[model samples]
Target chain A: AQSVAQPEDQVNVAEGNPLTVKCTYSVSGNPYLFWYVQYPNRGLQFLLKYITGDNLVKGSYGFEAEFNKSQTSFHLKKPSALVSDSALYFCAGGTHTDKLIFGTGTRLQVFP
Target chain B: AAGVIQSPRHLIKEKRETATLKCYPIPRHDTVYWYQQGPGQDPQFLISFYEKMQSDKGSIPDRFSAQQFSDYHSELNMSSLELGDSALYFCASSLVQGANTIYFGEGSWLTVV
Candidate 1:
């Protein structure tokens, strides 16, 4: 079975500073990795995905993720943080079984 | 065009009562999925339907059931609700079952007393 792990329960960052949210996965064959952001009382919004192309995949809201096959990691990153970026983030893996396995999720807090 | 839509944004139910949540998928989408989200946790897959047929279910109790109708809509029903069942439920739809992006609705908040 495919699964994902998010080591951090929460991440605190200052506005204008770089931020990173870590994620790792285990899957059979190739893995389709995705990142999503969720605000309070809202459903998840798609951020980015890594299917097979470049190691670094860019996504919405000036966010990007680096897919590292050796580390089994796909860490979401941003050059600078904003107070608006505070939210809960989730990492997921897509398998050939047509199901998505998600990590426990990480909450981000950006302070000005 | 509007994204996936879920009805009855908030619900409060008593134990042993039944609750039903509705969803309207995007036009032409063929697959619908249901997920449960607890406080401070990622959404957990509950069930998936494609072409109006049940496809996959995650680690959930039998009290949780779902159905897809005509590929454009779906419903999640819970019987004999428990306190542990209180959480936000989200409905999502994808163009296909495999290797496709799934879009989600705002979600419905279910509170069991």
Candidate 2:
């Protein structure tokens, strides 16, 4: 079965420091990975996605994710964390234009 | 820059009652999807429609049914609401033929008492 995992329940980082939220996925055929963020009681906002080509994909709000095929990982990263950046992050895998299987989600807290 | 729009941002219903949530996909989008998210839980796909036809289905319960209109908007009709049915129901849309990236709405917050 296709599944996604976020090993860390929470990730803490200081403001202006780099942040990484780990994600790994298991799937068959070509892999399509995506990152989404959600604020308290708010709908999810798209971050980025990886279908093919480059391993590194940049997305909205100064966020980027690295798609490591061999590692079966697509980790979300930000060069400098911000207090406002703190939110719940989810990693998902799916075929293009299909239902996505999501990870358990990781709460990212950036301290000021 | 129009995004998917949902109606009745909040709702409260009694057990066994019914509630309807509506969604208006971004213009030109041909696919609509419904999802349910409990408190602190990830969104789970319920159903999807393409060009007014059912495209895919997921973990949707028997108490819930959805359909897309000729205008491209969709509605999720939930019956026999249970306490566990209280959740945020989200409607998302995508072109499917081109972008393929699904865009979501603000979601309808349903509280069953």
Candidate 3:
């Protein structure tokens, strides 16, 4: 079975500081990892994905993620956090069966 | 291009009542997916349809059902609503089969009273 785990329930960071939301995965086959963000009362917005490429992947809103196969981790990162960037972050792993298993989610709070 | 669209942005239903949510995928997309999101939790996959056929059913209860119409539209039907069923429902579309990026709709909020 494919599954994702987000270790942190919440991540607090100051605006203009770097932020990291941790994620790890377990899958039987080659893993397809994805990151999504959700604001209050809105649907999830896709951030980025690691299908098979370089270790570091860049995404929207100045966000990026590092895919570490050895650690089974794909942690989302932003060079400089913005207050508006506060939202819920989700990590997901896709299996060969096409099912996407999502982590419990991590709340990102960017304090001004 | 227009992204996925779902109808009835909000719904309120009593216990045992039936609620139906509708979705229209992008013009050329071939896959439609349904997901449920509870407060402070990650979105959970309910079901998915591809090529006008039911492709996958997730951990959702049997009271929840879904159908795809002509590859462009889909519907989610909940036979008997309960308090636990109150959540936000999302519809998404994708072009290919496995592990592809998906476009999402604004989402419908269901409140079972």
Name the top lDDT candidate: 2
**Per-residue CA lDDT of candidate 3, range B52-76, in tens?**
8998989778999999987569999
lDDT of 2 by residue, B1-113 (tens): 99999999999999999999999999999999999999988899899999999999999999999999999999999999999999999998988888678788999999999
**Per-model TM against the reference:** 0.95, 0.98, 0.95
Question: Considering only N, C-alpha and C atoms within 3 Å, which residue pairs clash in candidate 3?
Answer: none
Q: Is the docking of candidate 1 incorrect, acceptable, medium or high quality?
A: medium
Clashing pairs in 1: none
TM-scores, chain B, all models: 0.93, 0.98, 0.94
Per residue, candidate 1 scores C-alpha lDDT tens digits across A16-106 of: 9999999999988889888999988788898988888899999999999999999999999999999999999999998643668889999
Residue lDDT tens for model 1, B1-113:
77999989999999999999999997888888888988766889898988898889886689988888764699998999999999999898887745477778899999999
DockQ of candidate 3 is 0.67
Q: What is the lDDT of residue A46 in candidate 2?
A: 87
Question: What share of the reference contacts is kept in model 2?
Answer: 0.59
Better of 2 and 3 by TM-score: 2
| Off by more than 4 A, model 1 | B97-99
Question: What's the true lDDT of residue B93 in model 3?
Answer: 88
